[model samples]
Target chain A: MASLIDLANPTRFMRLSAVLLPWLAAAAAVLLVVGFYLAWFSAPPDYQQGETVRILYVHVPAAWLAMMFYSMMALSALGTLVWRHPLADVAQKAAAPIGACFALICLVTGALWGKPMWGTYWVWDARLTSMLVLLLIYLGIIALWRVLDEPSRAGRAVAILTLIGFVNVPIIKFSVDWWNTLHQPASVFRMGGSTLDPSMLWPLLILAAGFTLFALALHMVSMRAEIMRRRVRTLTILEAERLDRLAAQGAPA
Target chain B: MNDLIAPLGPHADYILGSYAAVAVVLVGLAASILRDHAAQKKALAALEERGAGRRSGRRAS
Candidate 1:
């Protein structure tokens, strides 16, 4: 916990991230390349889905990250409410847009996949509907932050909303199982065992890892940028106040 | 996508489109992050310099 606080300190974070940035960026690039290669070439085509199944390389990972991002936001939200870490607000605010982007990718790719598989571009199946609601939650967070000028207040408000919206996450997960849905049930991560064939599993796993790392790299960069933005805003405000005082002193003295 | 793309054989517009979209968004996002960082750094530097100038003038008096 102490280590985490030290890491979260803005100056420490900036220094640490500066040292680690190149490594993370390189790892993201290398993993993405290998993952894409396997996904495109090495992985066998699905007997049922064929090449369209290749879209899973991108779709599944994005879908996973979409959920992961929301969970992260919830945790950051909690951090904001409980610890009130200065970095938490920056993290929470920085995460919103990226989470929304991942959600959008998930939705768009799901639609594209659905069109060929289910003969429809859109469906209100419980799984799809819940995911849509999740996307909306992300958007609402972004919108809330945008509307509120006060960062801490916005963080508090978002934290409450995120905690409430977290109830939808499990619903999103179980929706397909609970209903006669077009979407498939859990295949990759399951209690008994993964149903995926070895030929396909390796590529998917690599892609998933690549996506996770990529998200982390992006999040760190974004958090750093947000912290800097706040610092600059503070400096600007203080400068303006100082100028105001100087102008007053000079007036008809 | 494998279903639709495999049939297209040598030409798969949908597969191509998906890749294009992903590349564009990722690059755009990277660029935006870099630009924001640069702008913030500049603003911070300027503020620090101005603050230093004010301090020096205060010492002068």
Candidate 2:
């Protein structure tokens, strides 16, 4: 059993991830299949929303993942800035696009779910607007990552930005509570316990688990790619330097 | 077919469309990550093949 510190090594992380990815992917696939089956076939239609309530299966999970991935990124940022963990920035860089994708899914699905229920596809409500702002923050962080040429410089800059942007997470969560919005206040997770019936809650929980596992698998794959990319960059620079040194020594024409 | 979607009521399009959108986005995300991993792996392999050692003087095996 390797310690967390030992696993922080890029090479070790790569090996561990390679071993873990297949199992994670397999588990995610199975859970998603079961979850979808339950959501569509087993769960009954809502009394109020009717079949449109089916959309909650995908919408809620995507929304959860969008926020969850950002929280993970925030932790990774802390790892980079405070502890200087080797894989921290790699994790953060790999997560940005994935988190952004989940945010996009959340927004699109929410809109589709909204149109039939709320009679409008777009709303300027607190929750809806806050979620959109989160998507923008994700895009901005990604843009910052691209604009910086050096990985270390980009890592530090993006870490600062990610920390600053994290203020929106709690706001997004509490927006419905704080304001009279079309979006319902937290139903599944609340202080007095979930308002949802057990039948509906089961499928939602299962689907959320499936989505989370799938996202984590993707994150691991992306991190492995980032590590390999850095290796390629280092080797290429070394090769160029080697050639230059040989030329300077008059050993090569 | 009608029986299956009938339970989804008149809002069938919204429900089905939401699922479809999620599938597309998730699939696209997976494809892009796999593609990036392949490209980086190939590039790293090429560099190692060229006898380019790591900064720590490690010869990739």
Candidate 3:
């Protein structure tokens, strides 16, 4: 925990990520390659959905990351609110767009999967609607960050909204069970048992884990980039101010 | 290549599409990040050099 805290400092974070990015990139490559190969070929087709079942390779993982990324943002929001950690604010802010990307992927892939399997491309089904709402919430957080100019001010405001919006997470989770939707009920992570065969299950599980680590890697890189951007902005502002002072001094009484 | 592509299901398009989409997004992301890092590094280095040059120029007087 102390080491983790130490690394949260931007310089440490940058160094650690520079060292770690290559490994993460390689792992992401290998896992994604193997996972897709197995998902498309080795996994037996759904006795029902047939080949379309392969879409789960992207859809399920994206959906998981969408929600997982939001949870991370909300947690960082909490840290920002409590401790006023600037890096936490930067992380939460940086993660919004990435989470939104995953959420968009989930929504698109879900629709593609549904069109052939559920007989419609768009439905106001519970799961679909809630996931759509998640995407909108991510957008709202991003817009909030953009609208506020002061970094600390924006952090405080988004932290408040994040706490308020945390309720939607559980709502998204339970919507599939609570309503009759064309969407299938929970399969992999649920009570009773995982309905999936192990051959099929292993690939989904690996891809899911890979997506998660991949998201973490992306978030770290993005946050590092954001820190650098903010540093540049500050330097630019300071340089302009110094020039203004020099010009005034040279202007004479 | 046929052996590699053969085991793919009848819907070769969908599998290929997913792979292509992921690759495009990931590559785009890598390129953008590297570009951003390089841009910022060069800008900061330029500013520092200019600042140092001004300081030395003043000291030479």
Candidate 4:
């Protein structure tokens, strides 16, 4: 059992990811196939929403992943600030674009689901608005990563931004319940278990699992790329220093 | 099979549109990530090769 600290080393992390990425991609593919079948062909249509309910299969999972990636970033932020884990900021940086994509998917799909159900696509509902804010925060963190050249400095900045932005996570979760909104309240995850029938609940859960695995695979690949990028940067600097030394000695650089 | 599933009726366009949007976005993101990974790996390998060749030449000299 490799500890988190052990995996902080880039070489170790890359080696572990090489073994894990293929399995994750395979599992994600299989789950998505089965889950989509269940969601599309096996499940019964909702009494009210009908075929439009199929949108839930993808939308809910995207929304969940959007929030999940943010939460993961928050944890990575702690790792960067407190533990000073070398890979923490790398993980954080890689996760941002993926999370942002998911957030965009969630918002767009929710709007699509809303148009017919609510008679209009645009609304200023609490859940919708707060979720939009979450997407913006994810984008902001990504922008911050690009603007700062120094990884250590960017890491600190992003970590603080992520922590501060975390205040919106709970707000997004509770916005539906705390305020009267067009968005539906908790049906699947509630105190007394899901109100959804097992027929529907099972497929949604499977779809969510597939989406989670897919996101994990993407994050792992992105992190590996980030590590390689840093290695290239280091090697470039070393070569530049060598050239500078040779020039100082009046040797052909 | 198609009849059993029942068409989305008036909302068919919206529902299908949503799924299409998701597939497009996810595919695009995956492609972008893979492209970056390949480019970075190529860069790292090239840098290492150059550095190694230089070190060997210096040793021979």
**Cα shift from native, residue A221, model 4 (Å):** 0.2
Enumerate residue pairs that collide in model 4: none
Point out where model 2 deviates above 4 Å: A1-3, B1-4, B54-61
Interface RMSD of 3: 3.2
Candidate 4 structure quality by residue, lDDT tens digits, A1-253: 2485875699888988999999999999999999999998899989988889999999999999999999999999999999888999999999999999999999999999999999888799999999999999999999999999888899999999999999999998999889999899989988999988899999999999999999999999999999998888877877888887778989886
Candidate 1 error regions (>4 Å): A251-253, B1-11, B52-61
Model 3 per-residue lDDT tens digits across residues A16-40: 8899988887898788778877886
Model 4 DockQ class: medium
Clashing pairs in 1: A50-B2, A51-B1, A51-B2, A52-B1, A52-B2, A52-B3, A53-B2
Worst 10 residues of 2 chain A by lDDT: A1-10
Expressed as tens digits, the lDDT of each residue in B1-61 for candidate 4 is 5564347677887888899999999999999999999999999887776763354324322
The TM-score values for the models, in the order shown, are 0.91, 0.95, 0.88, 0.95
For candidate 4 chain A, which ten residues in a row score worst on lDDT?
A1-10
lDDT (Cα, tens digit) per residue for candidate 1, span A55-139: 7788788878888888888888888899888888788888777777777777887787778778887988888888899889988
lDDT of 4 at B59: 33
- For model 2, residues B1-61, the per-residue Cα lDDT tens digits are 8887776779898888898998899999999999999999999988887678645334566
The residue pairs found clashing in candidate 3 are none
Residue A38 miss distance in model 3 (angstroms) = 1.2
The Cα error of candidate 1 at residue A84, in Å, is 1.0
Residue B44, model 2: Cα distance from true site in angstroms: 0.5
Against the native complex, each candidate's DockQ, computed on alpha carbons, is 0.38, 0.72, 0.32, 0.64
The residue-level lDDT of candidate 4 at B52 comes to 32
